[model samples]
Target chain A: MATMTQSGKPADAIGLAPAAPIELDGITHNYGSRLALDKLSFRVREAEIFGLLGPNGSGKTTLFRILSTLMIPTGGAARIQGFDAGREPNRVRQRIGIVFQSRSVDVKLTAAENLKHQGHLYGLRGAHLQQRIAEVLERVGLLDRADDRVESLSGGQQRRVELAKGLIHAPSVLLLDEPSTGLDPGARRDLWQYLRTLRDQQGVTVLVTTHLMEEAEHCDRVAILSKGKLVALGSPAELKAKIGGDVVTFEAAGPEQAAQLAAEIRNRFGAAGTVLGSTVRVERDRGHRFLTEVVEAFPRRVESVSVARPSLEDVFIDCTGHRFWTEDAQPDPAGGKNKRGEY
Target chain B: MATVAAAAPQAKTASSPGIWTPAYSLWLREIVRFYRQKARVAGVIATPLLFWIVLGSGFAYSFHSSSGSGSYLAYFFPGSVVMIVLFTAIFSMMSLISDRNEGFLLSVLAAPVNRSAIVLGKVLGGATLAAIQGVIFLAFAPLVGDHPGAGAVLLSILAIVLISFELTALGFAIAWPMDSPQAFHAIVNLLLLPLWMLSGALFPADRASGWLAWLMRLNPLSYGVDALRNALFPAEHTLFPLDVNLGITAAFCVLVFAASWAIVNRRTHKPAA
Candidate 1:
């Protein structure tokens, strides 16, 4: 027997099973003359903690906007909870909870007050609203501090309260933009632990956006965007494994020397190495053996060499032919310097 | 892609609550937030009182004219109430920009509630505050020696609510697409203050010559001022009958509200999460 929905069937019309928790089919968006999202396509599965990974100008935010139905894409279609994001935003809005990159919690309001307003927005009231508020507050470990105004709480605690605010409506899917952005190490770990618990206990699907590679490691899967294009997609390990084996890098004294080392590696070892600034980079099956051979071949021409398993950054480099722009290199809290030189 | 059966959501229940819940909740928040801010309470009340005292006295001493013994304070008393209404109403609307900038509006926008509910909640909240301020300012009508009779008093309260709703909806229309409070302030001052000043609030619309009288006739707010003036000073000269004043001013309220509804219902220009 097939299931039936109130809006009629994609369910009973065919044995197509359930719709994806979120599906972006060639979603494209533009901001006047500049393109924001360029025909990007991906789907997030049920109970999955999906990450949209990208740096500044990479269009992760644009994709986030489309999925949340805050903005309609200029081209293509996106669906959330089986309803078109553009055509049926109110229906899509009902099924998802969104936590924005900026603070949405009112400083003057207590944790319970924030959740109370949120519950009302979702049509919950009176005893039902109070119980759900307490449930989500306890879920985020903030029940003891529910009476404190949000301004009185520490940054991490306030963030937890924000998470509580998002869950007050019992939304099936939670959409977060840069969830761990302002948190310290302990807070980030606790946040992800709570997210994983939500997935395991309640079968909730989570989609978050982040520029941090280490942050991407926590996600069940990641779709990497670069300059409005989907550059890569897979689980962290899967993307690394797609790099074949290890990544080999050799440092030369200058750009000219780096290009020379890359050409030499291509000719001698048949590895199509790329020159990134003053280093020659290669992805090979056995990077250690190649590293030794390349060092031995060039002797003193190569100043140093290293071979290591690939990270998401390496995967980005492999797909986009450029180094991943990381905040680790730039400490500014403001998303700064789109054209900064990369080594 | 064809092989992936993404987990469709559980079917939606058809019994979503009426839009009234969210609208009322949002309205309650505005009131709660307002009373909580001690400075805002002081400012809304103080500014109009000061405006009435200083401007009314100064203009009386300097620019005396015949409309009655016309203690300019008496003349400015009605305008002063309108000022209180204007300040409180526009002040509430200005919070829209700050909410957007500070990210509070994002959470409300993401909710399952209807867009009209949002407009209704916000506008009603602002109108309530503005109307309260207008009534408070009316308490000073005794000082100016223009205490209204019971019938006129009832009509005066109605006029205040209509004007507050009209101005707040006008503020909402102007402030909705604006991202910065400073920009909104600039647009409102340049556009709104002039509308108030020319709306027979500062000077008589009928006696003014050249383009000013013509401009006042064109101003919807002038009709509001005219209606309020008649309500407070019934024995004084009126440009139009009481019924005419109420009709045109009520018509202005509907026009601004419908325009505001159209602005909010359109998919907002703000980006998503």
Candidate 2:
């Protein structure tokens, strides 16, 4: 595999391993008085499927904007292939492909037309541009539908066109912001499969920002964020293994009862329970036996009990000391969209 | 399926692409989008034609121009052409708001293209459509009992093209900061409509009294209408000489285009919304 370096020097020659395709060096961003990203730093290894996992206000959207060169950070810098995303935005733009959370493909144009226009922006033209467009469409499995108007295509097909548009210029790094937001389960599975193929076959470094835990589980490594801070960073399995045992969850009547139950568990078995809303969670090696002992000690007090292997959500709770979905993350009963960047 | 390139391009950081190619691509997109919507093409032409016919006929008896010999319908022909230009040139930029809302603008902004190119491409696209519509309306000059020589026809085309460019650039400036088409519509009613009405489009500047006359004299579009009126009707008395009107109209075109370019580039200096 060939390693891409910004300085044009081989990675081994510079006494460094394979150069990171994307890097955020103490990046900070604030919307007016509200801080969206707080001196956050991370590096995505070359050709890896990296997931930026966070709840709505965890600053993933802001980070995505910075990486795509749509917005300059307030402080520090983001580098794609070692080019500054803020100061040298056009260069950064050339090296990275971006898929926005919202639909970016023009519905009025045919899929090929959209890709042709996108290619023109990156200075691709003539027969070379057409060949590139056809190649990208084929990679996304949309070659036959290239002549179809994007509006006529299914939502999944339209998204594939967007992916084709991003890939037309042959970018080294592909950045997707919630690529599977509107996708059905089957479409989403296809999207992940395609992303994996891009990484495995073309060596495109794929970085996806998603709020879905299941989506993060598919990433090779994930960066979990909370309140604009990096709380955990590792593969999902590694992060879960950090908890080192089974996850025992207990549901009580209310927050007060959950906190009381957590305190009792700490005092009785010397196991600390994390209280989240009306539930208490404790990590134990022999969770089956521990569940039996706890349930017998307080038969009627505990409403529900379950023991299972630690999932990514458990890792999140273990790191952040809260539930994955806060009250604000819940869907509004009145049908208002959840506000992002409020935390 | 053909394979993607095995390796990254590994090209050094290159400067942003020049203005013309991306501007042309964006321009092509606007034209394709406009013509694809058959209703937009019909509405832009039909609404003004309807307005000109009904309004010109109704006011034929009630209003009279300073040029006493020509009928009100004949006198309104140049103004009607300007109306077509204004509608096609100005309202076409309403696409910017929709583009932003639909995430199309986001993709363009993220592309490695110059900001000035964006303003140029959009303004030129609107101007092309507006100019074409205005020229089409000019072909109906014979219906109004006016016959122009070849020189007059060529000059009128020039005047229409300039007017189209100016109005489209002005629209780009107004629509750049606006996120909603409703706000742009409000601006059209408040500023653009008043600008046209007071530009001696409805009545000649010579007939208007006092401050109304001053407002007409101060209006840049008044010069455009004056220039077009001179071209289409060589016998009619124009508010300003053809040369002076074209000069001022040309200057305003440059001014508005520059203003739009500045507004767009200024957003880049700040955090993009």
Candidate 3:
């Protein structure tokens, strides 16, 4: 059995060598005057599935672009398998494969042709190229549809072809940006199964970016980013464990009144309270014990109250002071500015 | 069983070698793409024929003098052939823009292949398409005009290949940062029309005014036209010596190819979007 960590999950069974598959050191990227990534540093171990969990404009794509060598960082360094991403990009490229958020496969070509072309780009040809194309197609569960033009296939099928194209060259590391964007629930589950198989069977390190908490839960380790900075990094359970208690939440008349009530409750219970929008969330070890104090603190202010066991979403709300779904729906230019104008 | 188990991991590791393999593979794929598109093949064939038939007939009766040994068709046919190569070469830059917009360029860039190989492969693929188009157009030369001898035919093909290679390189050099395919097409049309006209693809360069003649002399396409004429109709009235035309055109091709290669190499390293 693999050694389990404090997060109550087994560490990677194969135990990749200390040589990092991807390493970013103080990487900073900017788009014009706005900073996209600020001194971001992380490492992905071999064969491990690393998730970049962030809201839109949190610079997750920018970080992925830097790792894939599509864009150079403005400051610091990024390396893949010890090859400098900027100075020796071709060396880095040779070691890794990337699937962009957009559909990369040519829709005009057959699935097989697209894979063959990708194989050719990697210098696979003759029998070897054919074999690899067939193998990747099979891996993605698109082998039977290899002869069909990509435009004729469903969106999920086309995405699978894109995955096959990326795998045709047998890259050591694969970077995918929102691979499950348009996939149906069933197809998304199927894709996840395929990804796990690739990791288990071939030991290919996978890095994926998604805003979905459920998708983030599937990763071996998750890095939560907000406003171009990493706020939390750990396994899903470990992140939830960071929260002190079951989350007790309620809507108030307004965030200003909510803040006042939250402060009074915190003064009595000595627990941290967060106000997002019109709702106030309090974290306490004993939810029943805090419920009485919370209501007694502000009887007229609290509109409704409910206590629930902490989830990854609650952990995100706790750390970032905002709900994931609400933040995802509204693009926060100021990075989750609450209704009371607090960031 | 033990030996086989030990060999399995080694075999998997050896399956992928980090080098020129992917680049070469992509080059081959581009060649395959060129051959697979029927519409592309038709366009390549039709464009040159339109030049040979429409442009050749429009200018047939307008000969200033029969000072050359041959008739108008013989004199103009070689120039049209070079024009064919130029048109085919320049128009192919649209494919580059298409590839970039389709995210195919990014896919190739992300691959482990050498960047130079991608540029060279595209150049070579465009040149090959141009060469095929030139060959088909040359075969129809007899029906449209006086046919060149066997040696001239072979040499004309060689000239067309060389000229196409240079023009394709020039197109890529210009197309690198073009935002869209339409923009590239506009630029190519604006540049190629005047270039062909000034290069004496339709008329003799000597007949142009002093400044226009100077511009024609500077135009690289002129050397290609002169070389084609020299190779096809060697006995025609010579504006410049045959050796001078061939030498200048060959040198220009080398210079253009090198310039395009350097530009593409630099652009590939830069962030496109």
Candidate 4:
């Protein structure tokens, strides 16, 4: 396990300098026989939008809960702003603000009242607390809706209220567990804009966990996790670059036909082709040239073909051997509509 | 860029330790919550008042001969106050269960606040609410029957506060480990109903059966009831042979409070299962 400074920059990074606000060290947690986080280690840099990208059941929420001091690790340690999460949780909590995956805002109370109550929990009160509440509500672009009950707000607006509640105390580090899980595209964009502003303007370290590939792209750095292990960690470009080349994908009739097409393409291009369900993916320096050859070689078998730059979605599929939107047990994407919401 | 310049420096100062911040703030919030929930406030006041009016009248004839010095309502007024304190304290503990389920408790735990502060703040807040209800019930005692001396009234109020604190602590300790609100309420019903019955609240300890007398002697609620009765009706002899039932009740209050505080603080600070 590696350690980092309060800025979340790796202490061991040569020229980069240490800048992280949170660090995890060899964290391994288990519930009975089932392992949740297996030797997980990562750093969230200060004033940077860091994303913990993982599919559901990949221990993202577990890590978030531990970092937020809701739970302790079964083994290893987590540090927030130089305070140990396990041994000095109050110190860590004092420095960090958290928004859980679930909507934690009090539905019975108005948005402003919820923020005021949360502010009080952290000892903010009177005019200072009221000012902070107004400031954060404005930051989330929900200042006008502050007097509205949370239950009366739309799902997206309610999420914004939750964000405002988390930021009411102006924590040094903010932990958001899938903050935009149920938002529409416009709402999500607005949220991302607010997060960016929070990072750039306030110098507040923002750590978020999301399965949304496009959302993960907004992060300054991302840690792609699978089965509780961080399989890839880097900037979005660096992670996509790990695929080595542009991704050429084509679909066939079935898995058997896809495998045969991949084999034929491998034989013709002398490059490795991987079969995922009825789709075959081949990576090459020049995706167009490879696609032309594959199309010419298996014209009848190749039902559809597309060539594109590698994305976080493709990177996730490449590393985990599963599509980002596809869930366990069902190969058909439509069978798991709600599962996508888990990200 | 201009906004960033203004907000960044303030962010650095946000995490500074303010030791009293969490407690005082949470305490004030609980009080505000109680005030806003009008139905709950009315319920807290009405429970003991109902017992005083209905039960005091129903037992009025019996207490005329047995109680000796005063009317039945007079004899039962202090007991009613104790009962009110007990009822309010136990019910208020259910808020812990509510807060935990609603994720408010988790939010508080995740904050920089001290665990002991959370426990003490909750206990004191609940006691304060219960004290208010007890005081309201005390005010109605004169209307229902006999009025105690001013010193006795003050002493009865103090005893009610102490009883409320003890019961609130006990309720917290019981409710802390409970997973669901239903389970917590069930436990409260199970523990409180029997404890209240055997406390001599409805009857004098001397009139109780031999087995019942032994149970009353050991019941903590009995001490509270006995102390309040002694303060209210100064003419009646002590419920027990010893003249130190108040001392015993005070000890019981302290013991219950310490135990409750320890249990709640430890439970809240422990890593969530």
Chain B TM-score per candidate, please: 0.92, 0.93, 0.85, 0.85
TM-score of chain A of each: 0.92, 0.90, 0.88, 0.87
Better of 1 and 2 by lDDT: 2
Q: Number of the top candidate by lDDT? A: 2
**Residue range A11-81, candidate 2, lDDT tens digits:** 43244444468888899987667677799988989899999999877888778878888777889888777
Give the count of colliding residue pairs in each prediction: 3, 0, 6, 8
Could you give candidate 4's per-residue lDDT for residues B1-82 as a string of tens digits?
5543443223244443364666666666667678778988888787777778888898887566364565777667767777
What are the C-alpha RMSDs, in order, of all predicted structures? 4.3, 4.4, 6.7, 5.6
DockQ winner between candidates 1 and 2: 1
**Model 2 agreement with the true structure over B69-111: per-residue lDDT tens digits:** 5699988888899999999877789988877767788888889
Residues A100-181 of candidate 4 have per-residue lDDT tens digits of 7665676767899889878877767789998999998888888998898787998888888888888887887888988887
What is the lDDT, from 0 to 100, of the residue B245 in candidate 4? 65
Worst 10 residues of 1 chain A by lDDT: A334-343
Sorted on DockQ, best first, the list reads 1, 2, 3, 4
TM-score of each: 0.93, 0.92, 0.87, 0.86
Alpha-carbon shift of residue A133 in model 2 (angstroms): 1.5
- Which 10-residue window in model 4 chain B sums to the lowest lDDT? B4-13
1 versus 3: better DockQ goes to:
1
